[model samples]
Target: MTVKQLSSSGQFNILCMPEPEREIDGVYIGDLLSWVMGKAEADNVWITIMSNINVIAVASLSDVSCVLLAEDVTLESDVLNTAKEKGINILSTPLSAYEAALKVSGMI
Candidate 1:
């Protein structure tokens, strides 16, 4: 599924969608930035609770389809802006990372 389709499906709330047409091939759930960077596959939806600026860097490096900020985590204004400038698709959800991952898994 594409980021736009996923967001419009009402499974999660989209926060920043600079690349809504990005394709989602899989899902990755992680909190450690380094771990996620090393393990997350390209074109996967990354689910994490961390909403820092570093998340944008990791997402760009890993080339993930999008970042799902779980458990209602909110990003700082600068971080959100950076995500937009960097063309990162970020979605937010009240669900935990596990739940978000499960939903994404079912989707793709």
Candidate 2:
């Protein structure tokens, strides 16, 4: 599933849609930035509760299709802007990280 389709399916709230058409090959759920950096595969949707600027960096470095912020986590203006500038798609959801991961798994 693409990021745009995922957002339109009513499962997630898109906070920053810089690359909505990006394809999601799989899902990776983790909060530890270092672990995610080493393990997250390209084209996978990374699901986490982290809403920091470093999330953008990790997503970029890991080459994930997008970043899904679980638990309704909100990003700061600067972080959001930087994500947009960097062409990183970010989706938010009220569900916990586990719930979001399950939903993404079903979609993919």
Candidate 3:
């Protein structure tokens, strides 16, 4: 299913949708930028506890479709703005990464 649908209709919260036009395989954990770059696929919904601007950068570099902040965290305006400029999707939810992963995994 689409990331937007998963967040809006599924069981998770999605914050931003810069590139909502894209579809991902499973909900990929958006943590350890380098690790994700090497491990995540192009269609994975990134679920990370990080809210740094670097997260957006890595998302772009990794060719990811969207990012989900899996926690009640606040992303800096600059980070969100960068994501918009980069055309990367961003989201946030009260659930932790692990929890979000579980919910997303069940979907696919």
lDDT of 2 by residue, 1-108 (tens): 889999897989988898888999999999999999888899999999888899999999899999999899999999999999999999999999999999988888
Q: Candidate 1, overall lDDT?
A: 0.92
Q: Work out the TM-score per prediction.
A: 0.97, 0.97, 0.87
Write down the lDDT of every candidate, Cα atoms only. 0.92, 0.92, 0.77
Question: Which ranges in model 3 have alpha carbons more than 4 Å from their true place?
Answer: none
Estimate the overall C-alpha local distance difference test score of candidate 2.
0.92
Which is the winner by lDDT between candidate 1 and candidate 3?
Answer: 1
lDDT (10s digit) by residue, model 3, range 8-101:
7545555567777687787677568889989988788778888888898788987876787777787888888888899888777788889877
Q: lDDT value for candidate 3?
A: 0.77
Clashing pairs in model 1? none
List pairs with backbone clashes in candidate 2.
Answer: none
Q: In model 2, which regions exceed 4 Å deviation?
A: none
lDDT of 1 by residue, 4-80 (tens): 99999797998889898999999999999999999999999999999888999999999999999999999999999
Cα displacement (Å) at residue 103, model 1:
1.1
The 10 consecutive residues of candidate 2 with the worst lDDT sum are 12-21
Q: By lDDT, highest first, what's the ranking?
A: 1, 2, 3
